[model samples]
Target: MKAQGIEVLLVFDPANMNYLTGYDGWSFYVPQLIVVALAEPEPLWIGRGIDLNGARETTYVEDANLYAYSDRYVHHDHRHPMDFVAHILRERELDNARIGLDMDSYYFSARGYEVLRRQMPHASFIDVTRLVSGLRSIKSPQELEYMRQAGQIMQRVMKVALGNVEPGIRQCDAVGEIYRAQMRGTQAYGGDYPAIAPMLPTGRGTSTPHLTWTDKPFVREEACILELAAARYHYHCPMARTVFMGDPPKRLVDAAMIVADGVQAALDAVKPGATCEAIEAAWRSVTAPRGIVKESRIGYSMGLNYPPDWGEHTMSLRPGDRSVLEPGMTFHLIPGIWMDDWGVEISESFVVTADGYELLAPFPRKLFVKP
Candidate 1:
């Protein structure tokens, strides 16, 4: 950024906040905070008093200005949070500076935008979200290790959950068992999202790839799909597997096998210099013959934050997304087949390498039928 003449960087979104400072909390309802990096000086953090300790402990920023409000008081009685943030920016003499703002992830509320506009009228705000995302796309060694651990845990939980699968079990019950199994380990917090809410889909419900868990129980020869995320040390590894309640109908099994083949083809295509479009095409080659039309990208990135603020949809799987397959880049390959009354999905996490990719989860892909 120094070579580009960028003087300061301001990060305000929750996702960016977590990325830069390990301050992970749902910040929507809370007062918005900003992490500012000046070219010469130490970084500064502007946040509410409630988050002071957390911000200090997790962030690299040493200078922190905090605004507090009395718990018993109403609006007019305390110092305004936005004003404090503005004051910090002004005190740093960053007004009129070329400031990089993470616009992709940071959306200012109407009032908050007005406050910044009034306070820093002279500053030019440039969108730097892409720069930051580009930097974040590749994982650090520590981040990769955490994701690998997350994958291991997910694989273990999958074994337990699949072993308990049977025709009589409700989808929700199976989901509950998986969640419980995940929680047994010390690393399990909540998932990147809810751990197991939209757990496994059964019967006709499998038609929707992201079908939420239902009270519907599994029946003989029906399709059942389990989509899950395992989070360890805040990193996530998302995976899915489809199975049968009994001996699955021959058609469903055939579809599952086709999807599995697509997944394998995608994994085989993953290597340095391979484009995302090329990977998607490999999967499409296998699925197209079986009449399974892909409506979404073949895969997406995985990281400390699953579904990292950017997703496969936002970053297309086209030729332009020349995000070369690099070592330490973790992604989820999800090849799905949508049918009239059911769908089959097989998702696995993989980390790109110099020659090939490493499969993070070692779970079985075949239809596991419960006796």
Candidate 2:
């Protein structure tokens, strides 16, 4: 924050909230925040009175740093919960400080920012959404263990989910099987809820990358793109593959080979001194000659996340992203292509190693063509 000239930070991103204090809950439906100031001994957690205990139970911080507002502030059209947070900031003598707000995050609602801006006229607010996000790009040993566990869970999940796919099974039923594997995890440990649910888009529906599953039955020759993550303690390991009900056409097989080769080239490009864009360029070099010009990014930095997203919004494996590769930084390298009539996704979640990068899950990186 000192680099950004931000003396006080108001963090509303749930992933960041979890990173800073280990506070976890589904209470993001309403207003809540984490306040960080230079002079403060501990960051403060402020939220609804009903959920204050939820914070206390989840966070390692002392009870003295927890503050809550009454229920009247919740769901009120005119009244907002951030007003209470602003009041506390003033009481703590941070009202006139150079405040920073996480304005670009999914959880930092416009109404919340408006209220904070109106409440603190004397304070300077700068957009610092990516400040904390950048700090979490590199994983510690413990965080890597949790991600490795998540990867193990995903390997089992992919095995069970793809094994159950057939011509007549409902897409929802297949997704249900994936969910079971996710919840059951390994026999050693249980799984945690994922940031996003199973994205098992079937048939030509795969052309749209983000569609959820439907109740429709799979037909012969149809394809399903399985985009899913198995999380352990909120650290996500996403895996994706294209599964076909019958013998896939040669076009798909060729595309699958291209994607796999491209992903490998990208992985080989990852090292301590490589740039993010250079890694993407390595993937692009393999596919560009095949007339596969993908506009979407092939990979991104990822780690601990919340609902609706699993990416660590700081860096991208794309053009102009100068962020150098570092050991222990994790990424989801998605060499997915959604053409007009078909789509194929064979992806990897990996962490940067001393020599190169390590794949989080050892699942086969191939398009599954089955009976």
Cand. 2 Cα-lDDT: 0.90
Best by lDDT: 2
Clashes by residue pair, model 2: none
Cα RMSD for candidates in order = 3.7, 0.9
Candidate 1 segments exceeding 4 Å error: 2-5, 26-31, 63-83, 106-111, 186-198, 219-221, 306-320
Most accurate candidate by TM-score? 2
Q: Which lDDT tens digits does candidate 1 get at residues 1-371?
A: 66545687766665456677666655435455554555445556665566666676776665434333333322333434556566677876776688776665534455555566677888777767656555666788888877777777788778867765677777678777888766664344333452234357778878877666766776777767887777775677778888776666777777778888888888899998888788888888888887777776777775654233324223345444666777877888877666678887788888888898988887887766664
Mind giving the per-residue lDDT tens digits that candidate 2 earns over 1-371?
89999899988889999999998999988888899999898999998898888998999878888999989998898999988888999999989989988788877788888898899999888988789988999999999999999999999999998887788888888888999999899999889999998897788788888999788888898898989999999999999999988888888888998999999999989999899999999999998898677888888999999988999888899999999989999999997899887999999999999989899998888889886
Q: Report the lDDT of model 2 for residue 358.
A: 91
Clashing pairs in model 1, backbone N/Cα/C closer than 3 A: none
Q: What is the TM-score of each predicted model, taking all chains together? A: 0.84, 0.98
Residue 243 error for model 1, in Å?
2.0
